[model samples]
Target: MNGGDVTEEAGEPVPESLWLATTSSTEYEPLPGDRRVDTAIVGGGIVGLTAAIRLKEAGHEVAVIETGRVVEGVTGHTTAKLTSQHGLRYDRLCSTFGREYARQYATANEAAIDAVERRVEEDGIECDFRRTEAYVYTESRSDGSDLLDETRAARRLGLPASYTETTPLPFDVEGAIRFDEQAEFHPRKYLLALAAAVDGDGSSVFETTRALDIDPGRQPRVTTDRGVVVADQVIVASHFPFFDRGGYFARVHPKRAYLLAVRISGEPPEGMFYSTATPPATIRGAPVDGERLLIVGGQGHEPGLDGPATSERYRRCEAFARERFEVESVEYRWSTHDLSPVDGVPFVGRLGPTTRNVYVGTGFDGWGMTGGIAAGTILADLIVNGSSPWADVFDPNRFTPAASAKALVEDNALVAARFLGDRIRTALAGSGTLPSPGEGTVVRQGGKPVAVSRGEDGELHAVSAVCPHMWCLVEWNDAERTWDCPCHGSRFDPDGTVRSGPALEDLTDRSG
Candidate 1:
């Protein structure tokens, strides 16, 4: 999945995120001990770091605790398009929410673009931030009609959108909705600068410190593996909220998407392009030491992958790239998961009814760059000014109609079925032990299902197959060599340490 799958193989492994592989790594030490700050942020992604800098500027001491390196999670693995046009989303927002609500959504995201530019200029972050246009196009004539509708709706909402019949792609598109003044950047480089701004100045950034739970109040206490952070407020920016008293698990569910960065013969497309046709693909380019790399992304599916095999996802995107562009070698490939909100809008305010000082910014769907930065502004404003004009649309307590609510329920049903049904199936034929090499599966050992895998070095490793999040039977992801929980998207490394969480505890080791 997006954030959890982080282990490099012994040799000849699929490359990790191009952003992480190319950028300079950070050096924030883990939380040393008890810390007292004005706010304690739980994740080190774009949303958390953005909020941290904003809070520190408002004279608030903030401490950001991360389970691993900052920006190396979901934020690093993204396509990195910093645009407000999220695949014809404005039309749906107007229909589901209304014109006014859609306007607020557009305003927050469009303003976030300017905010990022201002920070890059003021802080002098060399993140390859560039101005570009973003387009969502279709290859089919019928889908082009939908593009026209989106163009009109976006114009009504004051977005810089236009309908066009042409683009910079090598192939022809029936039509497209183009948004002007949108931008793309090196997300890790940009966030590292913000991370630097948050640290020092009496504020701190603590990496490799996992927050187990939060005791919320006016002076909220964040209990991490290292120590406790007592702060005036707690911000739950963790991609999947570890503490789920707000029932965020139900409201936001994870969907995994794959990306491949490949070298092309000629200069890549100059603008951000997303094809909304069959086998949807998002194409962009990144500068790597003067040569440009074409980024082909977007084959989103539920984490359980109840559909096609996971290995097929990477091939599909690569096929799309090779079909339209000049052939070269695929450089890097990785996958990521995002928590999509049942309602279109993300939750970006008070976390729950009882916890007033505890805040959250989650469920950006698959478009986090702008939504995440906008969350920082809304969250910071709520902490500093008591309210924000855009808070109503993203409030955690908004009403959910039964119709819109069914998507989440259906997603959960699949997860539940996978959990329960897999366990029963494993019980029927659980005699298999370890796979040959670079493979894993669940097998019966000592009356329990054990996740067994053999490394390329002929070494054996084993861990309990049960997931700690809700006792679901974990499935082996051969592509990542990790165990993924279908129930809630928590993932674990081969040796059983959590790579991602909703489950703070590791799997019970059975290797010995």
Candidate 2:
């Protein structure tokens, strides 16, 4: 879910995820006082909610504690594409990994989609759930042949994927692969409806309850700011689990991607689109009261560092949309962040052997919707019964031999480079004053370091320059107008309210 509505200017379009615009709305009060349950699921996105619902159905008492409003994390901001095609993953999975493992991954995704269709039909969710053919196309000259390998691998895995030389897209593609029976939906709508459905009986959702940490053991304890939720099992469904026991911080890196919802005059094509190129564009359309919205996304990077180039990508996508369809207005614009595992598959299962009862789901690789649902099902099976056929595949304990080694060395080297580079830059600029206003700048004020932002309104806001979580200097995000810590991914509002965490406290007011 995109974090709850932050302050936006009047007459200016607010930044809301595409899923938020499409999902149904409701007013849900935050959780009050202490609570204990058979299961406590942290994070209120699709994964957490799905796990809570399944646990409740299995006759376990459940409570979902969310730091912000439900469906406001990455899920709400997603392109909301639910497909098994993750950009030529089949060929790589079969080659780098193994054929059987690749097949299992494909089968799990298919099962996830089927499960969602069944739930949507049985529960009658009004979230615009629809099945559409999904495509992965590329214009890159040398790599067009990879599509053929992907098609063969997919066929070997018993998937309904095929290679296609032609598509409805205006641009010419050397090649593309089509995956049948993939899906798309209004994510926030599905999540909120799921919350309402789970509200009765054994399950409930608690918003505005921040989880501080966990005390793990045979019966793990989840610690929240308000109170504790001691349970037989605890699922950390937060986009990145608050607890970093599984070395997830090193295993997966956080990346940001932008999305724009455009009103199109032409009828939307019958299929969903993705590309096999860097800074790729993923496009699809949804009907809203006789009109169609062209949802385009895909300039991804490490959150705050993309610089001016990121905004240009969004503009380029807008131009592409206009070239294809009569551009109506840009209805919504937002960005989302996700944790992508180094090995390209999600880490879903027990957090670690030492803490058997604690489960986590992360590193979706842009396939969160399907991966998250499958994760919930796997976790539910683990908690309720004992074993699942899919356990070993997604097990956190299973290590990737070469992938893990390269990830550890390369990620650490990158982090060190960033840390040292920031220090050098700060030292060279003696005063630490920023180059301009309306940009995030670190400056020394009255012998103290501070973070300063000059808003579009010309009002200046200042806070402690040091990040609350790790003391890294915070950078200004021009697009979102927030302070982002380049080191640990903690984010704060322009006025210093905590957005994403590891930083439980707000940035201290420097003006005072």
Candidate 1: worst-modelled 10 consecutive residues by lDDT:
1-10
lDDT tens digits by residue: candidate 2, 1-512: 11122122213334777666655555555666667689989888888988888888889889898898888878888887888888788877776567777777888888888888888999998788899999998777677678888899898999889988888877687888999989988777777878997776756788888998898887788888888888888999988777878877677767777888877566677789988877677888976666777887677766534355444555655666665556667787888777778777788889877888899988887888888888888889888988766767678878777556787677766666666666555555555444355676767777666778887777788898677765677777776878877665778998899998767789999867
Pick the lDDT winner: 1
* TM-score, predicted candidate 1 vs. hidden true structure: 0.95
Q: Which regions of candidate 1 fall more than 4 Å away from where they truly are? A: 1-14
Model 2: lDDT to the true structure? 0.78
Candidates' C-alpha lDDT: 0.85, 0.78
Q: Once model 1 is optimally superposed onto the true structure by TM-score, how far is the C-alpha of residue 402 displaced, in angstroms?
A: 6.5
Give per-residue CA lDDT, model 1, range 1-512, as digits (tens): 11222122212324699889888889899998998988999999989998999999999999999998999889989999999999878888888888898899999999999999998898888999999999998888988778988999999999999999999999998999899999999999899988988999789999999999899866889999899999989999988878887888778877788888888899998899987865468899999888999998777877664565566666666666667777477888888888888787898998999998899999998889999999988999999999888988898888857325677678667767777687786788556455888888888888888888778888888899998887888887777778888766889998999898878889999877
